[model samples]
Structure formats: structure tokens, C-alpha cells
Target chain A: MDLRDKYGLLIDDMADMRATVRIQLADGGLEKCDQARNVKEAVQKLSLRRYDLIVCDYNLGQGADGQQLLELLRRRQILPLTTAFLIITGETSYEQVATAAEYAPDDYLLKPFTADALRTRLTRILEKKEALAPLYRHLGPKGDPVQALAVCDELLAQGSRYSLDILRHKGELLQTLNRSQEALALYEGVLQQRATPWATVGKARVLAAGGDDTAAKEQLAGALKAYPNYLAAYDSLAAILEKTDTEAAQAVMEQSLAVAPTTQRQRRVGALALENEDYVRAEEAFKRAVEKDRTGFFKSHDDYAGLARSYSAQGKVQEALATVKDMSQYFAASPALTARQAAVESQVYAKAGNAEAAKAALQKALQTRQGGDLDPATQLEIAQACFTSGSAEQAKDIIRNLAEDHHENDQVLAEAQKVFARAGLGDEGGVFLDATRKRMVKLNNDAVALAKAGELDQAIAMLTEAADRLRNNCQVAINAALALLMNIHRKGMDTSALARAHHYILQARHANPEHPRLEEVASFYRKVAPPGTLILDDE
Target chain B: MDTLLATVIHDAKNGLATLGAWLEQARAQTPSPALEEACRQAQRINTQLVELLALHRGSEGTLRLAIADHDLADFVDDLKAEWLAPPQSTITVSWPADAGRIGAWAFDAYQVKLVLLDVLRNALRHARTTVALRLAVEPGGGIRFTVQDDGPGFPVAHSATMHDQGSGLGLSFARLIAREHRTPNGKHGDIEMKNAPQGGALFSLILP
Candidate 1:
């Protein structure tokens, strides 16, 4: 209950972090606190007893993350209603968590926090948590979202000071219940009162999920203009752009990194440049990433491969060979890294006109990927190696499978197309490409035709089928999504349809780069979609 | 990091402030020859801190020096009064034996003060008896200041040079301060330390 009683918790993983926090907390008269190092420890401790305040880290190395742990505790009713949970994270990837709505913490804190700042944030969260306990208790575990929304609405209507937070919670709840349109409207209502960046980002999320990436980009861009140093906005904008404009995407990432350069962003930008064949930039970015975050768990032979590729491109064959050979000197014997080194070796050998050496290198890389513990990106890179080594047929199959599987994803589609084009399977690529285009068009027209003929069920059926078949096709996705939106609009004009249509439309635009209708449809989506579902303008 | 540098300067200044406080406290509590020596050591540290801060300011182009005209006789009189107040020391004034040459002149007041302070310190250190100062005008439209002490004179060839000195930065600092004034040939002003013909150390400043 008191600040002095909070620091005695036996959390080992973040002892340094705890010490730092303790120093600051001591300034605030807080001590004797309980702590959790990981999900298992946290859960085990929670099972025995409930702490008044639970300060948790989002990433716990392995198993359940902070959010997942929160969900588990909340779902099992092991966590006391009186206990407050605070999440901390180095990353700004809050939206990337698939079940974000399911395990929302009481409040989250960003890193590099000072004592005074942390104290201020914790004090506010404590105040709010106390105020909302009654409603939280009434809702209980496995609470009804509609009922929760009503409670939040009642609080907002009463003009509570916690209205913004309540509105956010309400929207998140709506998002969970698949009532994104209503949630979007609520978010927009909050935005109209003030230019809140998080609310704007929330709206962009709805737009992105509803399939309107252009709208999402626009919203994110607007937010970024106001909050240039806000890393989350840049990250969201970068995510949208990564599907279409690699150069613009890289620039946004670089800008973000310049403000608060992270190891992950550096690695991501480096890998993207490598894919784009901008080897020198990739190498430099990777080198900076390596030098900056020595403890980053995401380390790979990619840095070496990147440098190797850069050197090969620069016509320094010997240096390229030397760099790859030297990676083994420092790192442990990693088969995946060996594969990466082999891929680079093959490229170097091929550049040097040594076919036999290239083949041998390619075989080693193939062997590495076959060891079955490679990360997804590494697997993609290995697939790329296969294509580069004149195995077009094998590359075609790999890409086609990945494309069909992540068919609804714009970034994945672009990546798939790039791989196919790289393998010289342009005609086969065209068939898949043209078929996707024709199929999307037909699917859209079929759903529209079904809706116009007063066959609503058939229209819904047509859309559902289209959704299943060309899950990644933006046109079909948007059309099918639009049908559902129309259906929902007819049933009292709810905003959920708008959210869905927007998300699907964005996806479509991403899949078909330079599509003339992208901007037009996006503008239309903005008009019909719920206010919170509109992403900020890019330009 | 810029904040870190600022903090360092702040800490150093605070150290000097604390030393001053301790010196004052000691002066009241105990009076001994050894304690006087301790006080002088503390004063040296304080002076070093002041010079360091000035150097910092000079590097930043923020060191302020007011330029004004003052009679050489009045300037020497004011310095003599300050010297007489504390540890009294004998002083003598020498000129071209004429009044017209040792007239009023204008230069940076702070640099002039620093030059006089350095010469006075050197005089106090080595002059056991009397120190002499000479003021004159060069053949051109320039002014010259010369300080000579009655202690051992400096070595010939090396002592006349600018940078080569046992004290390291003080001589260089005096010369650097002198460069702010310009000569008639458009070169900056110059300062040099050497063995006076009579005895002891001699410091000279030539100003345009």
C-alpha cells in the first residue's frame, strides 16, 4: 500500500534494472516491492500471493511474454483484482502483438526512464487504478466487452478526468469484440477533442486492419508531423511503406533510427537493403547495428553476409571471401550462419567465375537451411540463394507456396514477387500475378452483383469464398470486405464494416503497387469508415 | 556530454570555493608559518582554477576584456597599493628617466591586469629584496612594460624564448593574452621573459 513496501521482491533477471528503479523509487519513498523475472516466476509467485504492484517486462527471453502472462493470470483468475500490473518494454511494437487486446496491462512504461519520471507515471497509474477498481470488480474476469464499454461510456458521460484512458480502453475492448468501427468512432471522438497521437495511431491501426494502408499511412504521417520524435508513429508508417516503397520505407526507418536508433531497426533496414541489392548501405547499417547493441539477441551471420555481399558488389572478391571466413572465427559453429556464409561464398565464387566452387557453396547453404532451426527471414534468404544459384524451379515452388500462404499480406506478396522475378520465372510469375488480378476483379464484381440482385446471403457467401481464396488480393479483399461493410451499414449503419473495408483496401493497394484507384478508394474509405479507422495521410 | 562538461567546470569552481572557505576558516583558527605556506598552496590551486576557467572561456570566444586608457604611473600605483596591503614587499619604478615616454595608453584592461599579476607573482617568488618596473615607448607607436627583480637572473638563450619555461602554461598564457593587442607592423602584441641585466627575472610586454 505504501511506497516503502514495494522493493523487496526477489526478481533476478532485471537486477540492474530493479536497482536503477529502486534508486528512483527510494527517492519517492517506495521500497519492499515484489518482482517477477519471467512468466513462470511471475505466475508462480502470483499463484502463491498477489503483490500490490506488479512491474513486468514485456520480453522475458522465452515462453509467454508480458502480455501473454497477463492474459494467463487474468484468465485463470489468479491475479487479484486489487493488484495493479505495469508493463515495461524496450520496443515500441505494442500493435504487433497478435492478441494485443486480450492481455492489456493496467499501464505500460517506456524505457530510459528517470526516477522522477517513473515516480510520476506510477503515481498516476496508481491513482487511476484505484478509481477504476469498482468498475473492474463489477466486470470481473471474463467480463463482457459491451458491458465494459457501457461502464466506460458512463464514466465518460459523467466527464471524468480519466475519460481519455477510459475511451482508449473502450476502443480496445471494441476492437477485441470485432467492433472496430464503433471503436474507431470512439477514437475519433477523442481525437476531435485533442490531437492525441496514440488515438490517431489507434485509428490508423483500424484502417490498416480494415485494409486501408494508404489511409493508415496518411494518419501515421500526420501524427509523425506533430510528433517527429515519436518512434511508434515512424514504425507504423514504415510498416505500411515496407509493402510498397522500399526506398521511402528505408528513409523513414533511417529517420527513426537517427532519432533513437535501435538494433532491430538497423538490422531490419540492413536486411531490406540487401533484398533491394543496396549492399553497401546494408553493410554499413549492419555494422553500426553490430557495434551498437552487443547484447542484441537478434545477432546473425547476416552482418558478415551483408559485408560480404557489399564487398562482392564493390569487386573486392578476396575481401568478401575473407569477411565470411572470419565470421566463424568469432561466433560459435552455427549451421544457419554457416549456410549464410556459404550463400555469400557462392555469390563471391560466382562473381569470380568459379562454377564448381559456387555449386559447392550453394550445397552447403542448402544443407544449413535443411537443419530446420533457421529463422523465417534466414529461410527466405536461403531460398534467395537457391534462386541465385540457377535453381529457378526450386525458387518458384518456395515463393509460390509462401505467396499463397501469406496471400493477404502486402509485404510478403512483394517479397514473393521479387523472389520469382529474381529467379527468371517471369512468365510463371505473370500467370500468378494476372490470375490474382483477374480473380480479385471477378470476386469483387461477383459480390457486388450478388448484393445488387437482392441475394444478400449469396453475396455474403461470395465474399466469404473470395476471402478464403484470394486472402491477399486487395481488390477482392476490399470488395468482399465492402460487401460485409454494406451489410452492416444496412443493419443500422454500424462502423465495423468501414473498419474492415479500410483494412482490406489497404492490403489491396499494397499488393498491387502503383494502382491508380489506391488513393481514390482510400479517400472513399475515409468518408465511409469510422473516424478512428482512418489512418493519417502519408504526405 | 555537453552537460557533463558544464558539470565538471561547476565541480571545479565549487572545489575552489570550498578551498577558499577552508583557508578563511584556518586563518581565523590558527596562524603559523607552515599554515601560511598551506594558504599559499591553496591560493595557487585557486589561481589555477581561475586560469582553467579563463582558458575554457577563451576557447569558447567568451572571455571578456575591456579596453581603456590609463596612465602607467596610476596603474603601477594601484598594483603597489594592493601589494602593500597583504604581505608587504619592496618596489621600485624605472622609466626612460623622462615623463613624456611613459604616458597614458589603451589596451585590453583584463590582459594588462593578467600581465601585471604574472610579473608580480614571479617577482614575489624570486625577488627576496626589491622589484623594479620600467615603462617606455618603442621607436614606433608602441608601448613597452618591463619588470625586473633583484633575485637570481634567468639563463640567457632559453629564458628569452616564449614557450620553454618551467611553469608550463603561465608564460604561454601571458603571451597568448599579449597576442590580442596588435603591433605597428600588424603582427599581434608580444611578451617575453628573460634575465635582467641587473639581476633576477625580467618580463617584458610590447604593445602596439
Candidate 2:
């Protein structure tokens, strides 16, 4: 069907720009079109009718920007695959836009365009869409990436000007499929034919995904040598250096920010600086992020917290306190943020030897935790602050609870260990950890011994008791249950046992992903589980 | 009318030439794709041509920013529709994610469309499949558009004496129009060209 016959919506803040675009579309034979001045008007129009295409400005006074509008539309499943959404932008730096691409849009129109040009681009996009309609349809409601790749392969074979796009899509699909080698090879093949930053970045992504930071950095370096302004290259290079070299990573982030200083990138740089303990740089970067986000959608309480963190670390206690108050004014809606500010305030008060004020701040923090789950990381920090203020018992209880709740989390465990060490309770913490581990292992070992002795009922009872006692030891619980179930429910694969195992494994995975033993347990459950069913064996 | 049209055209062309010259200088002093020159060439041509064309229409009292129900993707597609790159030269443009057919944007839609097309044409003529376009709308209030090619970007040496050689008028035109549409917040739209790290020229446009 022709696009002119399809209804569409056009949204722009400027009347002139809107009129200009409207005429251009008429010239291109698009007959049914409506216009809105901003996102609010656009939303009204959107609710009233379905449009085949949407032309929107990035900035619309109040409500949501074009990206957020699109995200909201997608979130609500309001826009369909057949519907086209285009964003109008006037940004010089791609960094901000790069983050937007993570959400995905159909097309972008830079300002100062002509009618003829718009016609040509729109026609091209329409034809390409028609070509990939089958794939689009099959990918279903929100878009299944794997199926999209398979469909792209068919379109690629059809041969067109968009083969590069198809190839890139295929590479992305392959990457998603965990076929990193194939994805890398595909990206490399594209690079061999022509040096494109996208292809180079694609290769770097593969390398990074493959756990080869050095190769990814090398590829990024080569690309940068050829095309220094390719922003993706800088981002990829920075990501690669992030883990191994904090100084280098900060330098890369700084360089990237110098080229295109977006609020998000600035925040990232600040957060990284804080991580690297570069308090001065962190303070500067966080301030810039706060300044930038103050007037844009990038506004986030995280930036405020980051600024507070930087100031606090630098011993600018009053400045930090003031920053939190400013944050409170804008972030009154976020209880967690209030809690964070309180935690920071308590630190400041404690440092100043104002015990009463510190206590009050801590109490405020506890109040914030009353109705909801505090983020574990934040809770850990508050607990640490409490311990430093001679509330060692409270700290001990907090760590103990956290350790038990996330028994499989090595990272959290290590962090908890450090916290304990700092609180002068390292030996006690270590002993607690050792005892917990021994208890879990002994539970499993005892069940195994009972099962081997031909006392199936006793073995099952022992496992049941063990599972009850070590409720948070997901891995052990799954194994012990499986062993008993293997002896008792050998009729035709124990569905109950499999279900329970899967639940424990899933929770364990959430707590400590990519564990070496996870896949083995999964396979075991798969071998003896019912088809198309899941069990929540988590305690 | 002719004088005004010519003046606008001249300004755009000169802007492109100057940009090309600067790029050449940058290329000679630096290494590789000489991106600044290439970007100048792309922006000048795209922006200037639109300005001149608009002016030409204005003189005749027909100057208007067209808005209608057009397939935005089709417009971008038409700019560089030919996919089969010549044996020795190639131009590859893909919509790795949906071939960019799910959305459309309105502005001086036609001018921006041509800016993308003109860029592709230049890449095809000067380089080959080295051309790629990435179009998206940011959560902020603007659109992000990118065009790139895998061929070695603008020749650095020739760029220095831009008016002396194949001085790029296309990029200049694009940039001029973009600048005109620039917002008072110093956020006017901009067109930038550079070399792709893998090996090509890239032109990026940010419009608000």
C-alpha cells in the first residue's frame, strides 16, 4: 500500500517547521497527516486515533521529550511495528543520542531540511520497511531480537542497498544469540571491506563480550586512529579500560566528555572518578552533570547523590549538606533518595562529632526503610555508618541478615567481609562465614550418606530438615532435594523435585550470576524435570 | 530575485569551500580520513543547496516548508536507493534494526532528506559502500542523524586548497541551512563530517 493513503501525525514546537514539513510530505504524496505543537497535544491526538507515521520534535515544552514519548508509547504498547515514528533533533553531539539509540527509533531528521530531501528519505524508509514486513510481523508485539535476525537473513538474501544494515543486524542478532565468534567474524568481514566505525565498534563489542578487553581496546585504537571523532569508538575504548585501569578509564571518559559532554556521560565520568577516588575530578564532573541535567530529561537523583558523595569525600561537609537539601527539593517524590541524603547527612554529622545530629540522621534513614526495601548497597553503607558510630551490634545484625539472604553472592560476601574488617570484627565475620559454609556442606553430605545407606525415607527426611535450616543456601538446597527426590520419586522424573531445584537455581543465579556450577545444576534439572513447567523451590 | 538566490547560493558554496580548505589543513597536519574536511564538505553541500533551493522558490513566492503524510523511510531510502555497489566501488546502507522503517520525523523534512542523500551520493562517488546512516530520536528534544562510508574520507591535501580543487559545495550547503535553523540557546542544528575509524567518511547532523 502507498504511504499517502496511510494516516500519520506530525508534532513540532515551531509552527514554521511544522508547516514546512507538512508541505514536504504532501509533495511526497502522503495525503493523510495531522499536526501537534508539543508532546501534550501529540498524546491527545495519539489517544484519539491511530497514525501510520509520527514526526516529533525532540523537545516539547513540559511532559516528555520525543524519546520519552516514544518510550512511553512503547511501554504502553501504543505504537505498532507498522507505525513509523521519527524524531527531529538539533544536537551537535551524538553522546546524548547514542544513549537514545538503546531504546530505538525509526528515523531522525536533522534541522534545515528541504521538502525534496524529506520525500526521498521517507520513500526509502517505507520501501525498506515493506521489504522487511514479514520479519517485523514475526518478531511480534515488542520485537523479539532472535527472530528478527532470522528474518533479516532472509531479507539480506533478497539483496538491496540496505545489505550493510542487514549485515549489521545479523551481527547484532548473532551477538544476542551468544554466537560471539560468528558475530566477531561478521563484523571483521565488514571491516575488511571498508573501515566503518560502526563495524569497528561492532568488533569491539564482540571482543568485549568475548572477555578480551585488550583486543577490544586495540580494535578501538585502530578505529580511532583512522576516525578520531567516531564517538562510539571512544565509548567502547572507555568501557574496555574501565575494569583494569581506573586512571586510564578516567582519562578516556574525560576525553569522551571533552568531545561530547552529555549529562549521562558526565555523570558516568563522575561516578567513575568517585570509584577511582579522584575526589576533585569527581566533584567537578558531578557538578557538570547536575548543571546539565537540571534543565533536561537527564535529570536524576543519582547525580545529586554523586555530587553529595564527592563533597563528602572531600570533607566539604556543609557543601554536601546543602547539595542534599537542594536534591531534596527536586527529589521529594523519591523516598530512597531521601534515605540516601539522610545517610550522607549522618556521615557528615558523625565526622563533625555531633553525635545527636548523627543519630537523628540515622533515625531518618531508618524511617525511609520502614515501608520499602532499601537497595542492598545503600543498606550496607548505612550499616557501615552505624557501626562507625559505635552501633556495632546493629551493624553486625545487618551484615548477618544480608549475608544470609544473599548466601550465594560472592561479591556481596566480599564486600561484607571488608565492612566487618573495617569495623574491627574481621575474625568474627570470618568465623561466621566459615560456620555457615560448613553447615551447608554438612547438610548435603549427611543427606548423601543417608541416601547411600538405602534408608530412602530417612534420607528424604534429613534433606527436608537440611533445606528447612539452610533456607537461603539455594545451591545446597537444590542439590539435597534432588538427591532425595532421585531416590524417592523415580517413577518418571520427579516434577516436584525438578520444580524446587529450578526455583533455587534461579534465585541463586540472580544472587550470583554466571556461577560455574549453575549450568551443571540447570542441566541436571532439565534432565529430570517436567516439560514446560517451573517450580519455585526457593525458601 | 536572481541576485538573492545567487547570493544565498554563493554564501553556501563559499562556506563549503572554506570548510574544505580547513579540513585539508587538518588532514595534512594530522593522519588518516581528515574528518573535519569531509564533514565540512558534507554539511556545506546539504545545507547550502537547501538554502539556495528554498531561496529560489521564495523568489517565485512558492517558498514553503512542505508537510504531508509521506513515508519518512522511503525519503531516506531514495537518497541512496541503489544497494548493489559497483565491483570496484560499493555503497552499503542497512537498517540493521528494522531498516529504519518504524518511525518518521517532521522538520524541513525534505532538506534534511537531501542532506542525507547528498552525503550518500558524495560517498558513493568519492568512496563507495563506505556509506552508512544511523538515524534516531533522543529522549531529549532532538533527532540524531549520522551518515558514514567505509572509503577513505576527504583527501586531506586537496582540502587545504579547497577552492582550487573539488571543493565540496554540498556539505557547506547543509551546514549553512543547519546553522540558520540553530536555536538561540546556541543549540542550532549542526552538520559534522569525519573519517570512520574503520576507514571512511562520516557526517553527523543534530537537529532540535
**Which of the numbered candidates is closest to the native, going by highest TM-score?**
2
> Candidate 2, residues A433-513: lDDT per residue as tens digits?
666656656666777787777666676676666555445556655555466446535555655655555656665455444
Quick one: best lDDT, which candidate? Answer: 2
RMSD of each: 20.5, 14.0
Error of 1 at A250 (Å): 2.5
Q: Candidate 2's error at B180, in angstroms? A: 25
| DockQ values of all predictions | 0.01, 0.04
Whole-model lDDT for model 2 versus the true structure? 0.65
Residue A419 of model 1 has an lDDT of 56
Consecutive 10-residue window with the lowest summed lDDT within model 1 chain B: B92-101
Question: lDDT tens string, model 1, A57-99?
Answer: 6666644466666766775678776676777664123323321
Model 1, A66: alpha-carbon shift in Å?
16
Error of 2 at B57 (Å): 31
DockQ score of the complex predicted as candidate 2: 0.04
